[model samples]
Target: MNTLTVYKLGRVEYEDGLTLMQRFAEARKQELIGDSLLLLEHSPVLTLGRGAKRENVLASDELLASEGVDLYQTNRGGDVTYHGPGQVVGYPIFLLPKERQDVRRYVRDVERCVIDSLAEYGLHAGIIPKWPGVWLGQEGAPDTRKIAAIGIHISRWLTTHGFALNVNTHLPHFNLIVPCGIREAGVTSMKRELGHLVSVPDVEDTLARHFCSVFESERRESGVSVRTVSITVLRGHGPEARVLMVRRIPERGGFWQTITGRVEPGESPEQTAARELKEETGLDVPVRALDYRHAFALGEILPPMLVEETAFVAWCPEGHEVRLSAEHDAHEWVSPNTALERLEYRGLREGVKRAVALRGELTGG
Candidate 1:
């Protein structure tokens, strides 16, 4: 019973996160590092997997770029696919004995995470034995939707470039390319399937729990952790109001340093942030007056999703009661000072400061 190290990074575009996970997995295999998982969301990118055909990408490179899309090649086992805003992608890097290697089993476990997550929002998902990933509705249901899609790469028994769950995703983004090389297979998000908005944190929480449960049961169970931190500004009675020092969420608790989720079509980042905050922490806060303007990296660590991100600053109600959506088990409100001490990321802390500063400077601090 050793503590499994779970490292959660946030708001990384598709390719950067994917590339880091792959490299991390390789490093873990090279040196016997304990089990670890990297969870985050990606920007828009059209990724072609090992089995993908170039024809699956209908848009030319120049055209895709003009429309803010990226293309990439991945080692994962699948064909052409799209990863953009509103999707959560996970990569778990671990080591396994030769006999413990099971590709199909590992993939099914990833799909299970999506299924369990979808069920939390009252959407039941199943698998089409003929295909991988989780399917929407029952086997014979008409107008079935895809709740989640999983494509991964496993090397020397380690895994990377995991599942992508369409939560509050923009479905039109998929029209630019043929998803998973299936010309007719349509893509759907949780919000789309449910006919309303769902919380990203809620989906992420369910997915994380499912990932831990399935992955642990099949292999050397490692550690699972979760945490909460707030980024705030520190001001004294003077003109020099300083941005609060950011802390790192302990490695013992899963760390989600960057909290950027996708804006479902028609939704602004402020609206999405407010909704996501409410879903993760039960509260109603108006995003209308909140500051909106921040920089985010726009590129899939894969093929296409090299788009620019428009950021926003969300302000919660002063004393609102928090109803923990099934997504977060615990919550805390800390100043940037405490956040920097408690959160496990250094670079992301700086990003938060820059984001906060940008919001203030642009909107009149």
Candidate 2:
């Protein structure tokens, strides 16, 4: 049986998460990594998929901006949909077996993951004919409500952009667009159905476990010695926010990266982040945790190990001079786009984007 690696990134910006999905899909296509699942919540944003129609977005650019929601044009299948704080977005990078490459079956399996998860919460979710996500109430019933949405993209038999389950999502946001281009049915969430606040982490765990079951895969555990910490350094607030990235030494092939280091004995991830920040860039700023955590396999040595990472963000006062450690040769303060382009690793790039989004939330950008 194939083993699936799961990364629970607490909350990420929509576009950053999309870029990470594309990178993972490409890697899976090349057989660089095994099948993986990325579970995250997106900061309030509306995305238009490949088949999306502009007409479905009822709000003007000004309205969306004023409401603090970002709009993005994406390449996933399906129409316009809203993703925000209370939604769980799962992006599965899976290489399909030759006999199981049917797109319809893949989608059905994705829906089954959501259906089975909902069942654990005592909600009977099923599929609506011709629709791609899990729904409630009988088909053809006027009261049917959509609880999950699936939009995917495939390349060389590898899949990306899996599904979004509405847990405690703000329903009013969906009014800004015709979700999945479906006007007949309404949208609902676990919180709505259960008449209580459903924690995102609880739903994430249940969904991930069921996803493995539906795909006939086992979830892999991380090695104890593979713990690490990464930090996203930011300057300024809101639209003016800039991320700090360092270029590794020539011996390391000069790849750009954020502050990263391994945790020492008796040190928490946050403590490691702070120490790494001071050591790498001579910055002593306070660190705050972000909703991001991911693990990746490393090395070709016997019994390959997994590196589990916890991410944090720190504010660098403007004009702070960076003193590079021997580990890095150069450093730069750049916009998220430049950081994303310069960073070699998908995880680091996503970390930078998450930092930018965190700044927006903090400063109300």
- Candidate 2 residue-wise lDDT at 201: 86
Error of 1 at 24 (Å): 1.6
RMSD of 2: 5.3
lDDT of 2 by residue, 271-346 (tens): 9999999999999989988867665545433233446678899999877898989999888888878888887665
lDDT of 1 at 280: 53
Clashes of each: 35, 1
User: Candidate 1: misplaced stretches above 4 Å?
Assistant: 97-99, 138-142, 217-365
Error of 2 at 172 (Å): 2.2
Clashes, model 2 = 1
Candidate 1 structure quality by residue, lDDT tens digits, 254-335: 4444343456667755667666656655545543322222222232222122222333344544445556554344555555
Looking at model 1, which ten-residue stretch has the lowest summed lDDT?
221-230
Q: Each candidate's TM vs. the true structure?
A: 0.59, 0.71
